[model samples]
Target: MAKKPKSDPNYKVIAENRRARHDYAIDEDLEVGIVLMGSEVKSLREGGANIAESYAAVEEGELWLVNGRIAPYAQAKTWGHEERRKRKLLASKRELARLWNATQRKGMTLVPLVLYFNHKGLAKMKIGIAKGKKHHDKRADAAKQDWNRQKARLLRDKG
Candidate 1:
């Protein structure tokens, strides 16, 4: 999870894919830089972005963020960026190789988890290496959560 720093004004989440965790079992997550245009950055600063339907992919030896949407900046009408363009994600060569191997050989997915600006105000994204969860898995998770809640309530009442 992306932790927001209490004292940093620039540390803000632009967009988050809340359903990613519910649909996928994340093995690991990595933060990587995103290549954004000026207009896209402006839009993101205004909280005009969505990662709900976005994903990451290691393509042709490079990482790409696909289907991410950054609403066009109204002020940059002449030079606005495409809302749903494929953006390049920057990561170390070693990390890229590992991600590629996980996706290709291990059959894992690269799911976009969160899009945010770091403490220094640079835009970054968290990508999760995950496997898809089945319907039964979701149900079991819900049941477990319910049981925990009930157990907590019972202990509280007994005390």
Candidate 2:
């Protein structure tokens, strides 16, 4: 995970699906707005959320985030939201159409990459259009990464 710069107080990462990149070959990603209740927002600000097992989908001509968990805020007893309810994602009509086409026609999956508050303090999520990686592909990628790491170490030692 990339560290958030200390200078930016508003930018905070609440959750990240780190395994998404290892399991899927991401083609592209987009930042989208999320609809959240007051309690949900408060919970997120406390950094209590999980996106590792969640994913995004385009259904009924709209985008939705499924399986994401936001822990309930303790103070808001009556207003607390469901921990694992489906949340609506906001995107332009054209982007929605493109995402639908990618999933239906191109055989791609919409994976939630990261969930965070942007610089403006609004909750946003980054979703990637990706295709599943086969076992052999994953192995090859791991081998390539290992080689790159060793090569960099050797170069540093030589210089």
Off by over 4 Å in 1: none
- Local accuracy of candidate 1 as per-residue lDDT tens digits, 1-159: 998989999899989999999999999999999999999999999999999998999999999999999998999988888999899999999999999999985558999999999999999999999999999999999999999999999999999
**TM-scores, each model vs. reference:** 0.97, 0.96
Give model 2's TM-score versus the native structure.
0.96
Score residue 37 of candidate 2 by CA lDDT: 97
- Per-residue lDDT of candidate 2, residues 7-124 (tens digit): 8899999999999999999999999999999999999999999999999999999999999999999999977799999999999999999999999855599999999998899999
Report how far off residue 141 is in candidate 1 (Å): 0.7
Best by TM-score: 1
Clashes of each: 0, 0
Off by over 4 Å in 2: 1-6
